[model samples]
Target chain A: MPENSAGTLAPPPAAKPKIKPPRRFAGTLYRGREGMWSWVLHRITGIAIYFFLLVHILDTSIVRISPQAYNGVINEYKTPLMGLGELALVIAIGFHALNGLRIILIDFWSVGARHQRLMFVIVILLWIVLVAGFAPRQIMNIILEAQGHGSA
Target chain B: MTTETIPAPRSSYTPPRKRRVNWEKWGWLYMRVSGLFLVVLIFGHLFVNLVSGAGVRAIDFAFVAGKWADPFWMVWDTLMLVLALIHGANGMRTVTNDYAHRPILRKTLLGAILVSTVVLLVLGILVIYTFDPCPSNAIAGTLPAFCKAH
Candidate 1:
């Protein structure tokens, strides 16, 4: 017991438990490799595609109103910004679908668990090939349109 | 008479625990099942909208109206909409539970997801069911080309 300024006996100060500082970037998005990275990217692309689906549904549903109204909304998608956005969306979908396949294989196939890392690598490689095949054409179109040499 | 008291025999039957709903397990199952369906639905959707016939340029009000005129397309679109939305919302719920450290934040995120998913589903369903390609009161110039025939 310790005495206060009034000289009355008071409860002794509680022992302070030693708290360790958290490691640098502990429990963060950047902390993991391979499977962890796949998990994080899968969550991210899933969310992105989810939001895209919401917008796509809403936009497509607008055709019920009138043609002009629907076209007015969709015409904005022709811009360079939207073209790039579409490219990103394609990339997201590519990764999500591939990674989802990997996940399915892991869950259902006996040998999938053993080669999950290999599967992840394959997914990434396939994703790169898909994006590489898709993006350049889109980028070229955007650039060509910007330069006023628009291709029909 | 040295009769030894026998210890009571262990109960042969163990009591069953109360059965609670296993929501997580069901949610996991739903993701896989719905995902399998989504692969086919989504790829078909993309193929039609971007590859079939005249491709993306052919997609417009008339195209959608033509497709919806068929009951098969209507059913396909509706099923895709409902399945994908539920799958996505449930997947997001898992993400929120994993990452959202604070209780209030987690609940709020989940609530938002639920409300948005429900609202979108309702809106999509309404659009699918109530769609009229050829409205009587439509402005003549703004109407889809097919509507002109009527």
Candidate 2:
């Protein structure tokens, strides 16, 4: 036994490779660039919209729940802060919508690789239109009311 | 000893169909383009809502009801709803196509996406427009009298 223990070489210990923190921006969209950022943002907004949708449904159901509570919630929205929240909802919905349209075109195979920029421009323009059209009222309403003048 | 003389080689044959553009080329384009838009739409949305003011605490029922009450917000929201749903559905459609190998399964999934998008869009729009924060027939002490035609 002593001879065998001494003569036989112990099995080589398997090398435990150092595990680096999983690459921070591994395989990010567009090499960790704008496109990647957009992608991450889109997914985040999508999830946000979905959560908002659930809350939205429940809140709307308050019409049946009790008008008092519904009205109370409604009044809460009149504040400047709530107005801003509405604006966010607008922005999220706008992005989701316009980009979604681009996605629709892609699904139909209407736009080709040559027109990626074209389509991107179109979606951006549409988003701009949506935001521009809605944001002013939200902003102005809050501003005017704060200054003691009703938002006309 | 026999010496063999090799014959000259004939011209090579070529297929005529190599010049066609592929459908997938279009699909790839769509992914990039749509992805670009989704970014702005999404981020703008986040900035406006969660970062603009008091953030998440400000969200409430009237907040939504008030927005929808206006035609401007109505149109904005309606557009957003339709677009987001379609973009999402379409995005999902691309993922489905890439993943669903079987022809029948692919078609079925695509069809489902189409149907669901249409249905959801319709329902969502209806909710936006037909929303009655204060119903006329609401129970006593429930509805604000403004809703009742005096």
Candidate that would win on lDDT: 1
Across residues A47-145, which tens digit of lDDT does each residue of candidate 2 receive?
566556545544554554555676566556567886787788778877766655655554556554345446667877888997997787668766654
- For model 1 the TM-score comes to 0.77
DockQ of candidate 2, scored on C-alphas against the true complex (2 decimals): 0.08
Which tens-of-lDDT digit does each residue in B43-138 have in candidate 1? 688667643454443455667778988899999999999999999999889889989999999999999999999999999999989999787656
Candidate 1 chain B, which ten residues in sequence have the lowest lDDT sum? B50-59
Q: What is the DockQ of each candidate?
A: 0.23, 0.08
TM-score of chain B of each: 0.85, 0.62
Residue A74 CA error for candidate 1 (Å)? 1.0
